[model samples]
Target: MPDTLYDALIARVRSSTKARVVVEAAALTGGLIDRGLIRSVVDLDRGEVDAIFDELTRGRVLQAVGKNRWRFHHELLREVAAELSPPSVQRRLHIRIADALVAGAADGTPEWPQVAHHYEKAQRFDEAASAYQKASINARQRGALIESQNHLARALENVERLPASHARDLHEVDIRLERGFLSSTATGHASAEAAAEFERCLQLISDEPGLALYATFSGLWSYYATRGDLRRATQLVEALRLRLADMPDWYRAATDAVFGSLAVFRGEFDSARAILEAAALAVESLDSAEIEGAWFAPNDPVAGMYTFVGFTRFIQGDLAGAEESFTKMERRCQTLPFPHGPFTLCYGHTIESLIRTEAGQTDRAAQLLGDVAAIGQQAGFDEWVMIAASAGANTSSRSPVAGGARDPAALEEHIQNLTVVVEAWRAAELISFLCWYDAALAQTLLAAGRKEEARDRVDLALQMAQETDWHIYDAELLRIRAQTHDCADAVEADLRAALELARRQGALVFELRAAADAFRWGGEPHRAELLAVLDRFPAGQDWPDLARLRSLVG
Candidate 1:
């Protein structure tokens, strides 16, 4: 925790280029090791600590050699203590700056920092430049514009730094997207390739224990998300969850948020909420997510647990509440420029509609749905889905539907917000979510009296479900199946299967939705049966069906 300890770690890391170790130590000490030019974090007792302090005042570490009073031969001190004093452990601090210079620097920038003759220093500019470029590319891909810009500036600071080499092209693409230009598949491909390259760089630093894990987490997130392999993504996330078990409590929130997202995708909103409870209430960027190594609580610094708590306040019908989150998100997350996913915004909007609908403000709900449709139209695909019993859903509730026919003006306003799904998918792009889209299409067609088309859409939705390993979300598609049914027995069987599936997965949310469909398709007897099952489902949800649930409850 001493200033000397902090400086020692920085100094050693400068020579060694193994920053992960320093960061690991920082993580271990709960960040007490930062702030000062402390040479290193030592577990010295009273007498020994005092002796080191006395020596520090006289510039004992390096004053004779013109080195700063803060500088020290950390490795040498450990040797001396080992021979003549109380027991101690010391590390050959390897600075990542050294490695970055070796790997990336072409020339300039190292002179100012003044690495001693004993330090084998190369140029420092290139590594920072290269890291900036790589980070910029990743940040842009994940839509972190500010973060990308910050890194771009760092890379550019190196006078000899080449024009954004590895991810140069991507650098521009992110800029274009920020300016609202349409991004192409070629651009997406470039982004993915850039990501893979960054991953390779990270793996090269495998000697740094905790850093390697984050690089691993990054590679896996992009890979499975791109492939739509939620199953594999879920598994890897679970592994990270277990891996971070002994980590500091501060690190727990970020890891859990990622894990909770998979749970949401897997239709586990309950689990997702539980994990998100930490982040949702607190309002800030989860920097703790990247802090690596065997985690120990950082000393005395207040983290954002309080802020996350404020962020999570919402009711089922609060569209205003939902919008409030977006406001908070924009405010709290301003500095976290790119490589982060748009999961928060997209998910926030999705829940906004649900909450608005649940609050009986169907018009506002419809507007929200239209807003998302526009995002999908422009962004290529709105590639988000609520899947598991884990974590995920949107909310903040208020209702215009509390009155009989709803507030006429609000209803009109909501209707005005609807986006005509003139095309089969967003803009001209193929749908990323076939099952959900197809199922939704079938319902629209059925309502519009296009029964034949409805039946076909439903059939396709079901077929897609049968082929995918993500059989869990297959329930969304199953709603279409009942409409395809002509016989009582067929309808009954489908309803029964869906009900069973919902219960098996703890998909009470979706189950409640399906109960409404069952009432429509199952007729009097099945409606009675489904309603009874629906009784166990939580009463509130941000959807039109909340009305049905309300009616049933009454």
Candidate 2:
């Protein structure tokens, strides 16, 4: 009684009441205190509760925060009291409270963090691990990616407590995979942390080759692709193909989708399209259950395949086809249940806006880009926000939207904003996106008649693209160069080079645009070949590239 508040609180909880009563009250109160809530102890026997409350209040250990609610005057008082309880007694109380809170809940879902805390305190590590994993999922759904990652780390810590067993290993692998996926999504590219997790998963699941393949395809390839390690990504693709000889249809389909995505990054458009088309068909054939387990859930692999398909078609001047593919992806994503976190959704909207802009749907494109900016900002998706801003700026400079025509001053402001974002990406070592935005900025500068600055920007972009093997925009960069160069002969040479690169990459849209430029620069022999390329596209006449081609050819 004469001791300080902490000592007195601990001694009182330990000696005043039966262990059951003390531990129960401590457990319930500890949880409430952690949540910054104060509660009245009405559930305990009225006489006992009154006596305990009065005793604590008299000692100045508990204080009334509200009319009928009381809390420990200081958090240390509650912590000390909880620590002083017998370990077994504390564990049992934790379990009892966890059960009560988990059951009879208002919502059917458990409060994962609270449940995880109780399970961990009770030393029920397996349950703790599961609860933490669920908490991570919930956090991810709410766009709390760093919180999700922290939960996964705690889950893995609990996983380490279990005795060695196949089930334990599987749990560890699952947690690592989820962590890897979350890290990749949060960063807009694979991080070394994600790669390490995926590598650990591969090692853990070595006996299960199918699961190993899943790990490799789900994360490793993306890491290599994002890092510009095309050779390693190609090796992974080949390994997956070899393994596919014996894998199930769903697995093969998912693997093919991943391979298709890799090929898209490699600028192998024809091969990418073929593989993705097969993947799309395979996904369509899947039954409900197979589809559920086929890809990493919540971020569907089939939806990703459609994203690549749409992007590939967009680059090929098949605007209508690209629109169809993007619409399909959006529809598939809509079917996912709550907490539909950003995955390809932001990218889809960003690119779709670009397509809309090029097709002269300026107002609609502006609205979609606005959505992209908003979603990216809310979700902490910096890469998508940068991409959306770059695309939006370019679109605004070229054509009027709901806003009036962008004057020279507005265009310069957009360029300056884009420069800041691009530099930030560069500083962050987001190499692929940096290169992409450099090209975009170059195009914007060219459009604004800043030929010297545009030339310098495009050259830098081309250098980065070649250094990184990110040739997806190679032809476009060359075309931008053609626009910025002063000499007619230099422009002709640049356009011809662009045409060749576009043809090699099967970027038909770039090819048409370059050929149109060549014809415009008085390279008369390009006329017949340009018409033939334009004729191959069944639609997209309204697209800027095709429209320019048609005008020149006519």
Best by TM-score: 2
**lDDT per residue (tens digit) for residues 287-317 in model 2:** 5345443344224677778888888887777
Worst 10 residues of 1 by lDDT: 388-397
lDDT of 1 at 120: 19
Q: Where in model 2 is the C-alpha error above 4 Å?
A: 1-85, 92-108, 162-169, 190-192, 203-208, 244-248, 288-299, 337-341, 358-362, 400-415, 433-436, 444-453, 483-490
TM-score of 2: 0.78
Off by over 4 Å in 1: 1-191, 198-208, 268-343, 354-362, 366-434, 449-452, 466-468, 471-473, 520-524, 527-534, 537-544, 552-554
lDDT of candidate 2 vs native?
0.71
